[model samples]
Target: MQKCGLTEKSPGQYVDTIATDAYVWYEENWQHDEYDHSHQRYQLTYVEEGYQYFHIEKKIYLVPQNHVIWIPTGKEHRTTSEAKTVNLMLVLFKSVSELEFYQNVHVFSAPAVLKEMLRYASKWNKVLTEDTEQQIFLQAIQNSLPHFCKESSGLQIPVPTDSRLIPICSYINANYQYHFDSDVLADKAKMSIRSLQRIFKQETGITLQKYMQLIRILKSIELIDTQQFTLSEIAFKVGYQSLPAFTSSYYAIMKTKPKLKR
Candidate 1:
């Protein structure tokens, strides 16, 4: 087996270039580079322990523990983790059958059976050849993926690509913990309030207020995972002065109230 050596550019370049049908790559306490790249094979990233952030274009998706992020073939994206102690397992497949689920990026639940399968498959760090039991096993896992991916994590937020709206999105992302007013946002975009509303919706397909709410909820999820703050504290930290208002907004997007882990 030819092991991939560390490169100054990107540690994943070696594995990404491998010419194989199925491969498993597991990392513990891994720190990723900021470089953006794409893979030829379809990739399934199982978050074995901590959260893995997937970036595609201007959107960012957070895949937490017991969840898997499916990245289709030829989709350019950047993946990184923020946890000090994180475990991630990557399963890459080539020549896979085209299914609706496999056509786009998704962050879905990883079932218990799939988790066990991934753990067992982690032993085979390199490529698995065809007609062998290893390949057969991997094929079974691939077949079972869609069944386990029925629901998404709903942790993604997209930034607008329009030059006029770019600074506006950046400001919301940076200052999500603060209340945003239409006047402030319009001023930030250097446009009138009416034009700002129209152009922002046309560019992002969501209202500017809705976009800010989504960012706030997304940030709240990250803060909730740390388990250091109470639910009220989290609400305030994420720009909600009233706990009920924060809870309402969170439930509206997440379909559940904000609660801290005991």
Candidate 2:
């Protein structure tokens, strides 16, 4: 909570770091909220833990661990987290940036070094510099980024044509209010539990349970920010059955408690 707090982001409001093309915020307790973006900005998010959904181009992308989702300039995008999520952000503008030569979604196994670099950035330490030395450090990250990943071939999931997992996925999407487990998901997907687990990790880079958490976190975030329900109301709405469990999960994802206005 000490490191993750109000400085990161606040509901219905946005922070502008006018001085630097880079901005980073780690909400140790970065809770759920839907935010609208304007002008043009690109983001590289490392999901330290928890779940997140990116609403972009009429598609919903579930972002999980070692998992990074990048949104390019002028793209209408929104982010919501259900778990206590550690968010490492590298936001840049088209003008002051060198990433223009690259485009489209890039997903690679985040290198241990890049993970360390992002860890440094997400520290919420305000002492970062655009100094010649610091610039090289940052550039090293940017230059090395586009190469680690080849083109996606427009596939987010690696489900085989013969895979029967779609039915299970559809059921989970429809019944997210209920608790999900590997056995249940496997039954629904009509694959052996072990195979379902393997394919899920291969396809989404995370387990089925992780994806479910992302969905719950997204639902909780929407309700909390919109005030469509009281804390307890949203808790049960997202299948927590209790406020403490929901809060615990929320804080676990965001690394901070939801600020209640007096």
Q: Write the per-residue lDDT of candidate 1 for residues 5-80, one digit (tens) a residue.
A: 1122444443444545787778777566666766577888888776778888777887867788888987888777
Tell me the number of clashing residue pairs for each predicted model. Answer: 0, 15
Error of 1 at 173 (Å): 1.4
Residue-by-residue lDDT tens digits, candidate 2, 2-113: 1211223434343544454554555445554476543344556666655466666535665645556666656666666555334544435333344563455554446687
**C-alpha lDDT of all candidate models, in order:** 0.77, 0.58
Candidate 2 wrongly placed segments (more than 4 Å) = 1-17, 84-87, 91-101, 122-124, 127-129, 150-172, 175-262
The candidate 2 region of ten consecutive residues with least summed lDDT is: 1-10
